[model samples]
Target chain A: METNDKINQMNDDELNKIHSDSLGLNVPENYFFESKNRILNKVVTKEEPKTIPFYRKKTIWFAAATLTLFLGLTVCNKYAALDEQKIADQLTDSIAQIDNENGATAVSKNNFNNQIPNISLTAENDILVSSLFVEEKEVDQYITNCILEDM
Target chain B: MANESDFIDQLISETHRDNAFKKLLDLYQVRLYWHIRKLVITHENADDVLQNTFIRVYKSLANFSQQSSLYTWMYKIAYNESIRFLEQNKNKHSISIEDVNTKYLNCLLEDTFFEGDAMQLKLQTAVSELNYKQRQIFNMKYYDDLKFREIATILEMKEGTIKTLYYNAVKFIENNIEILPVKKGESVQNTENI
Candidate 1:
């Protein structure tokens, strides 16, 4: 009765015809046969968040670039900074040997001071200065020499 | 249909639930497919929304509560799911509603499942032009043949408001739908009281 009352609103035959034969969308053959599993599959997998492809995700691309730069910095720090003290000590020892071979102490020390303007370690014989490692002013001088060499 | 409360009871039960759900799908899927088809305007889209609707219905079984008829509750889900699909598609493709409607019409024309003639196409076009809420009112009232009270319940609108919206939608369709044909003696113009 409600359906009839609603249909009665279109009184004219042309209007009625249009209303009666609204849309003629064809249903596909066997369409229903496969849809059950298809829908069930989606429901089963719905709990897992659908992953946006890495290439498509802007965040993923940004993260990959950030990780690469971070790793490069880490490798540079490990290889470069850890070896600095050993390299500095070995260079000091080699220079002392060269000075001793020349049979000159004060003259060799003066020449060494001139060569490395940044390194300032006081010594009567250069050996005492070379043997030192982290007595405030000496460590500062070592750091300055390393920085100058790096620059 | 009167035994629907029993059906719901069985659906909520663990033992009879799976069989009852399969039965529910078999009964409602075809009806829902056509209902969604009229709104979404494509076989592929309707098929997708139908699946989604059933999936939602299955998940939301605990909430059924028999507040409305089973089909009506399911119908509400189908309605919401279809609209959500349309909105998502519109945003995903970066198209205006007008552009989206045009694309749907084009799809309707090309789809193998669309066997409508010119007038049918014109009716669909007119429906597409109505305000979205008005289209919802119109489809529920006209095609689905649902009562104003039921539609009001589904849409959560007042009955009077739904009546006004439906009338307004009918008038809108009347104005927008061309290809109004008449018999040999009848006049081209229509005269009537609202």
Candidate 2:
């Protein structure tokens, strides 16, 4: 029985025949091949920058312009700040000069008012000499005190 | 070293002089797609991953080493890329063993991308029973017809380990098929054929 079974065993040709007996299945004729070819061609095709969307191109240009403007403004702001500081300094000097003139005029008027009795009683010649000498001395003393206080 | 230099020269010259890259795309795209499809188990995801793989290959062609065959290196890249895609999408769906096996089987049955021969179907069934690494080794070796050494380079495994995996996978398929029940005349005919 084992010898008969051994004789009955099929060979490679018989197996090939069995496989061949089945229906031959070909790839369906459909859109897949054409679509795949289209995809492949699209992938391999060289695309230029112009082919990109307008919005994206515009965004790139906008970004570049914005950066350039920002840098230019930053440089301009630095120079502008320096010029503003110079103008501010000149205005501050003018204000200091006005303050000095007002202070001196107030001191002189106070001295003149305090010598009222001598100005009313005396004739013009006598009052003028005394007033002039006293005022000169007072003004000298006032100027010395003002200089010391300032220092 | 000389062989490596020669291969690099060939690749560089091919890049410069000919459209050999289109031939490469035709040869590798389907195989790589199927390999990635098995891992990802979704046609759309597989398609995207396959395109990304080719794009990366095109970008990094200048830095490619010639120590291995171009296919081996490409397979390695594709395998890693598939794993990375899986990792990135791991949160989208929780993958289970049963889910993986069922999806893999269904993809093989439904995918129009491959040549659906009877032997290919049988091979797919055989592969479905294997563990993940075993399935990978079997597919690379049997379906892709890659050498064990090339597979080792692709999978970064020892050659001996890949050999053992292939052997075990084949044995498992054969044993599983042998134990299936049969009718009397059918059994007699099947035994006779064997």
Candidate 3:
């Protein structure tokens, strides 16, 4: 081992003079320039933003259209409900006008009575009842005539 | 042009990355080409390995941990790529690694780009005789002129180990430097055994 070390040390001294600066390896002219250009081309290809064609954006457009359609349907349903409400309000107003002009029929009077609970009439409630145009005796005679006709 | 840290920042940043990488290629391409040439021993192979090395460097810049210098890191990648190329060629030809080296070396004289004389050929043969690690350590030290510390970092070996391997490789070359009058053809096996 000592002899080997001595030989190695000697070789080191000798080899120090003999540099490996050139091993007679030569490249083709412009090899580095060509290689760098090739590598840069590859890198540039990778770095460029990938563009999706308009046809390929189908899912995004599809989702947007569906959402718009859903919103439109929801708004239409809401307005339709409001129109129904407005028609109801108009019908109620018309009925109130008719009652104001022609007074209460027996059916409407009975419906109003059915809606109210039985209670001792206060003086104010008696006045409200007396203000109605319908007479109770006439309503009873009309009812008696309808029963006779049916018989 | 900036300090290495600033340069690394530019390399990892999106806006400045492409220009920084081009600068990197300009700075290291020739140096790396020669380094790889000494190992794989052909202009074509060196060109391939160098390009691959730079491409890897660009892709892996974001992951560059600053523990080692960028120079050391790039050398490590080039070394690995060269080894990988040699291994792939060996597998493709169904030959041993030594045979692969021999195959390339035999073709050296015929290669249009190889201008090596008999002495250089002798030296290359002596180098090829060294084991894989010793050959790598010796080449980096002798040709690339990297310090023992730098070689240790590149090869991930202890400095003392690299020194020892380099010395041994040199000794082997010195002992084996019988001047080859001509390139060995079929007799390469006999000469290597000697």
Highest-DockQ candidate:
3
Per-residue lDDT for B82-155 in model 1, tens only?
A: 88888898899897666776576787788876777788888778877777778778777665657888889888
TM-score of each: 0.56, 0.51, 0.61
Q: Mind listing the fnat for each candidate? A: 0.53, 0.02, 0.57
Compute DockQ for each candidate against the true complex: 0.20, 0.03, 0.22
Query: Candidate 1: global Cα-lDDT?
Result: 0.71
Q: Could you say which candidate leads in lDDT?
A: 3
Q: Which sequence of candidate numbers ranks them by DockQ, best first?
A: 3, 1, 2
| Candidate numbers, best lDDT first, in rank order | 3, 1, 2
Model 1, position B157: C-alpha lDDT score:
91
Q: Comparing 1 and 2 by TM-score, which wins? A: 1
Ranking by TM-score: 3, 1, 2
Question: Candidate 1 — which pairs collide?
Answer: A26-B113
The TM-score of candidate 1 is 0.56
How high is the CA lDDT of each candidate model? Answer: 0.71, 0.59, 0.72
Across residues B27-49, which tens digit of lDDT does each residue of candidate 2 receive?
46655765676666556667778
- Kindly list the per-residue Cα lDDT of model 3 for residues B1-194, writing each as its tens digit: 23789989988998888887887776677667777876777677777888889889989989999898898899999989998988888889888777766665776666677776778877777887788788888778766657889899988889888877887776687679863222224232233222
Which consecutive 10 residues in model 3 chain A have the weakest lDDT in total?
Answer: A13-22
